[model samples]
Target: MKSDMSDTNNHGKEISDDAFATLIRNQFQLESLGERLQKIENETATMKDKWRRGDEAMRDFTVITITPTEFTLGTE
Candidate 1:
């Protein structure tokens, strides 16, 4: 959620009438919006998978042992 890049400024760019109209039209189209939403959902699912795998790896490396006297920490 945090980005290292600064905000971008579109000061020097030029857009033709057709291109601008197409951009505006796409914003209002249901099909285009649905496709975009689907893409975002897929990306989110992929990130969650990666996080799950990382957690599993960390658990695999961690070992916690408990006894009557004290607790011990180790890696396997």
Candidate 2:
């Protein structure tokens, strides 16, 4: 009778242990997903910065005009 009782308790503990393991695995997966999302966000920010710099550089450029006697440079 004692052995049977212990077996029953062990069986219950095994089920609970499996549940805990699954929970831990899910937590790790969520952490991994968060890291991936952060990396993507960083990359997107870098691309936006690059585009902004390019736009600013374009704005800084000006056109040059030349007449027979003189030359002029102007920005739009």
Best prediction by TM-score: 2
User: Which residue pairs of candidate 2 clash?
Assistant: none
Residue 17's lDDT in candidate 1: 60
Count: clashes, candidate 1: 0
Scanning candidate 1 in windows of ten residues, the lowest lDDT window is: 1-10
Candidate 1 global lDDT: 0.67
Runs of candidate 1 exceeding 4 Å displacement: 1-28, 64-76
Q: Candidates' lDDT values, in order? A: 0.67, 0.67
TM-scores of the candidates are 0.47, 0.59
RMSD from true fold, candidate 2: 9.7
Model 1: how far is 8 from its true place, Å? 42
Q: Write the per-residue lDDT of candidate 1 for residues 1-76, one digit (tens) a residue.
A: 2222222243545566676567557766978889999999999999999999999878765534345346445733
